[model samples]
Target: MNHRQSGSMDSVTIAFELMRLELGAEVDNLNAYGASLFHESQYEEATKLGERGKALRGFLEKVQLLEAEWVNSFAGTAEVDYQDPAVEAATRQILSNSKSPKTALLVRYPCGEVVAEKKGADTLIEVIKRAGAERVAKLGILVNSENIVSRTPSKKYNEARVPPHFIKTHSSTAQKKRNIEQISDALGLGLTVEIIS
Candidate 1:
């Protein structure tokens, strides 16, 4: 399921939680929880429950592919759709495996962009650029306000920063040239500019 269609973050979070709860159940019989939930036309909730099983399975497949790439790398995880049971089950299997490390390099974002199907292949480069930006922010050496999982037409999000004085650095994408130009003009006080593609 396209998670973007999940309506809102609150609903998505709730649905994912329910999906988690359902996947771990060992019995085939419907629990009192299922009866009460499914009878009320809470199909979304029901889907959530079904998805755990699917995510676990997907997770396993991801781990196998990642394992093929590195000898000792921690098993990879599948991102839960929180909408499909088979997908969720696969995700669960991948994430819950004891072999997977706690700090596994889960691909949360590739170049400040998050989508099931990426348009470009420079995500790894994007990740490195993002890391550089974070380090710069830690040092207070640069402004660090680019949205990870960037958007098209680049609508500014209400992003909150921990170090309020820190500046956000943006990557160079021709698509964002106008916004970048505007932003650079706004930072007219001789702020340091770093260009990244």
Candidate 2:
């Protein structure tokens, strides 16, 4: 796995590559459509297609730059591996139930207690607060991809008078790191994405 703290292309880099391929195809399609419309003498529709093609071309260029930037940002990242049978079990369980992928935060407090929970709104802070962490020295955060189960509850009950529920859709990993970094910085803690095989 390329989870080491070295500057190398990772999954995000690969995803950007795939995105570029798709965008390139879209741009080609738009150009072909525009040319066809022009041949049919529909000047107004042809102009619209041409403009859309231009916009897609511009966006494709931006994606390339962004991909380069993303690849360059992975210098000396401090990635730690989280090793705990219980935690691993919990993570697997959460992932099995989750409809969408989730990020888990493993928080180690000053009192030598480690808490593993899903990353969400102020989850780290809330854990610290709930743990009653005072006179803090430092905090360590481990981030890893996990599964988050989002259940859709029914307002009305079934024939058995039981409210039924099901899973639904949700939302990314690199962007997740950025968001986690903001919160970790705000809380004055060290953060690292955990390496999982």
Candidate 3:
């Protein structure tokens, strides 16, 4: 889980720790190759375990990187700039697959003003539009608000978040809150709202 945060000791090391506890020398040699690769600056190959006894910690990132390379390998090697549009284009392709619909993206920033904000609806709409995902609104949203009790008067409040999508674009908590009234205004609208604290 430390891998979820950016500046941890790197999950690869954590994996080695776990493997050392579980399998001892049967896995000690596995870490040796990764250590050489890490020090030699040959990240991709260095981490390669030949018929290994342990699973990797941050292996998904490696798989993603390798998959990205394999998709582009025929074009000959090019410097992989993560911020490049080619990466974005590939992402769009993944997102647009009709077989799986995903939620519209959500982002949050401290409103920064001293004023209170019931502005989630507007913020969510704008974010979707900016991502060229305005069409996602028709599918509806599921707002997952949490009202944390303040220990001190006017205590810090953490806003709720939209979860990861299992499917291209559908709904999110922000979208739900935005359209709740519209859903209610209609007769026989099959909608329910739940708030968690």
Candidate 4:
């Protein structure tokens, strides 16, 4: 199998490939019907395609997880080809889940040198304060909009209903900016905050 970067293939393409690999002779017929239903915007039939795609993805993830467990259990002596496309894809998926926040506070010195990079508002503020407010010139807070927007179900509830406030308070862009602004005010530093989608 040819190993390609995660960015090289979209979710749909990956799903198709997985189905072809696992289902063998049945993939062509199934894909043809799925494509027809999707193009016609047939929600009922299209749902089946979506479910199948999700199942394939889940299967791939599970296989990867099992492979990882086996390798770990046998110690570091297992001869595994990390270059295989399936292994690479699975590893990428696992790593993507564990990725650090792209959002960071860039601390710069008076001489226009970036002295430190810290993730999260609280830690960044603490570090800057410790570095001494007089030595720092400008502060840049980078926010990734995708991370700020909540995709998971909110646990907090208001009057028997899940309120939007739960998500907003935890990760909304507006809330993050407000927190950063407050930090800037406290530290008496010039703030350059950018929200990237």
The whole-model lDDT of each prediction reads 0.33, 0.43, 0.33, 0.40
Put down candidate 1 lDDT per residue, 59-170, tens digits, no spaces.
5445434434432232123233455666545544543331311110113332344321131113323332435434433332211123432322222222223332222222
Q: What's the candidate order when arranged by decreasing TM-score?
A: 2, 4, 3, 1
lDDT of 3 at 99: 31
> What TM-score do all the candidates reach, one by one?
0.17, 0.35, 0.19, 0.25
Please report how far candidate 2 places residue 55 from its true position, in Å: 1.3
Question: How much does each candidate deviate from the true structure in C-alpha RMSD?
Answer: 21.0, 22.4, 22.5, 19.4
Residue 180, candidate 3: C-alpha displacement in angstroms: 26
Cα lDDT tens digits for candidate 2, 1-197: 33342213333554665576556545545655665677789999989888887887789779978876765665224243333456445544543333322334445555566555454323434443453233111232212211111123322111111122121111122223333454446565565432010
Among these predicted structures, which one has the highest lDDT?
2
Best by TM-score: 2
Model 2's alpha-carbon lDDT is: 0.43
**Model 3 over residues 1-197: C-alpha lDDT tens digits?**
23233222222332333332233222333454445556778866754563342354245235434544543552223333234356445543432331311222223323422211244333443443333232333344322111111112211112323322211112223233334434333323333332111
Error of 2 at 27 (Å): 0.3
Clashing pairs in 4: none
Model 4 TM-score (2 dp): 0.25
